[model samples]
Target chain A: MLKKLLEFLILWIIWTLLTWSLALPDILAGVVVSAIAVLLFSDLFPAEIGRLLHPRRLFWGLVYLPVFFWQVVKSNFDVAYRVFHPTMPIRPGIVKVRTSLRSEIARTFLANSITLTPGTLTVDCVDDHLYIHWINIISEDPEEETRLIVEKFEKYLRKIFD
Target chain B: MSNLVIIFLSIGLFFNFAGCLGLIRFPDIYNRLQASTKCVTLGTIFILLAVVIHFGWNSISLKAILCVVFILLTSPTAAHAIARGSHRAGFPLWEGSIMDRYREDQEGETESAN
Candidate 1:
């Protein structure tokens, strides 16, 4: 029951922010819409609502954002450099890396972060291991690969989700 | 203000162009996904950032930021799904590819299950 209310509240907040409206009709519509959404998809939502709003987790999430944005920008430049370079220096391959993040949400974020970062895309994830396609293939050792790719994101995700 | 918008727009276009070029140039599905996902996602974000700047801090700008959040969340997941699908469907890597530990792991898993 509490979960349902929390979900509805979140959806209502998103609706308010997206519409940026305080009109009576708009607010009422958001309430109705969010209630319906919560009823329909409540079971699909994550089980732990309390941890989501934890102050430490929220702080870590905020810190993660700028770090993630910087990585995205750096990777964009790297890809641009490769795409325009005459030699087209790339050694594409797939490698496996292990992650310590046990929770689904944390693993998903870790995989997405890997995909968005430099010269790497997460091809698949099974259990603790993630299969990553590397554009550059710098090292063949799995530990080295994980260190270069997963650890950077996993450290922060551990705090947020795990 | 307009100059900032133009600057962001130009940076966005450059990344988008690189993504397109990578789509054409990369030898395999996974490599192409790598290039396209990173460059294009960043490109679209920058483009939307320009929209936010152009509109300033109004509802339109907030909507643009929301779009950025959606794109950032969705694009990589979509790319991941495609890459996983292509691999499981037995799409061959490029001839110049160096390694494929994923296939090895899959084979190992099947053998152990057997």
Candidate 2:
């Protein structure tokens, strides 16, 4: 019941912001639409909301953003350099790296981070391991690969989502 | 302020162009996705950041920020879905590829499932 209410509230808030208006008709329509959405798709919502608003998680999330952006900028340059080089140097491959995150949300977040960072793109996630397609196969060791790709993001995500 | 916006816009356009170049030059689907996802996503975010800066404190800037958040959330997931689907559909990696751990893992799974 609380989950449904939360979902409805969130949807209504988003609708209100998107519309950027506070007329009575808009508010009433938002309420009606959000309620219907919650009723129809409550099952798709996450089961746990207990830690979603925790203070520590919020703090870590704030810290994670700058770190994520810095990495994105650096990697964008790296990729751009590769794109323009006289000889396109790349040794692409699918290698597996294991994640310590237990929550599905955290794992998905990690995969997305990997996809955006450096030369790695997540091909699949099987159980605890993520198969990443790396453009430059630098290290053959699985542990090293995991550290290079997953370490920086996973630690913060572990605090935020796990 | 306008100068800053132009700088961001140019950076975004350059990356977007690079991403397209990669898409055309890359050997296979997975590699193309890697290039397009990373470069294009950052490119779009930078472009949206310019929009926010240009609009200042207004509803348009707020919407631009919201678009950035949405792109950050959805772009990689879309790429991941395509890569996973292509691999499952037996899309081959480049001939010069180094390894195939996903296929190996799949074989291992079937052996255990049996």
Q: What is candidate 2's TM-score for chain A?
A: 0.90
Off by over 4 Å in 1: A19-40, B107-114
Clashes of 2: 0
lDDT of 1 by residue, A1-162 (tens): 888888898899999998898999999999999999999999978776578689999999999999999999999988889888989899988998889998887888898999999999988887678888898998989889989998889889999999
Encode model 1's per-residue lDDT on B1-114: one tens digit a residue.
699999999989989999999999887888889889999998988899999999888889988999898899999999999998888889999999999988987823653465
Q: Could you tell me the TM-score of candidate 2? A: 0.93
CAPRI quality of model 2: medium
The per-candidate count of clashes, in order, stands at: 0, 0
In angstroms, give how far residue B93 of model 2 lies from its true place.
0.4
lDDT values for all models: 0.89, 0.89
The sequence of per-residue lDDT tens digits that candidate 2 reaches over residues B35-104 is: 7998999999889999999989998888888889889989999999999999888999999999988888
Clashing pairs in 2: none
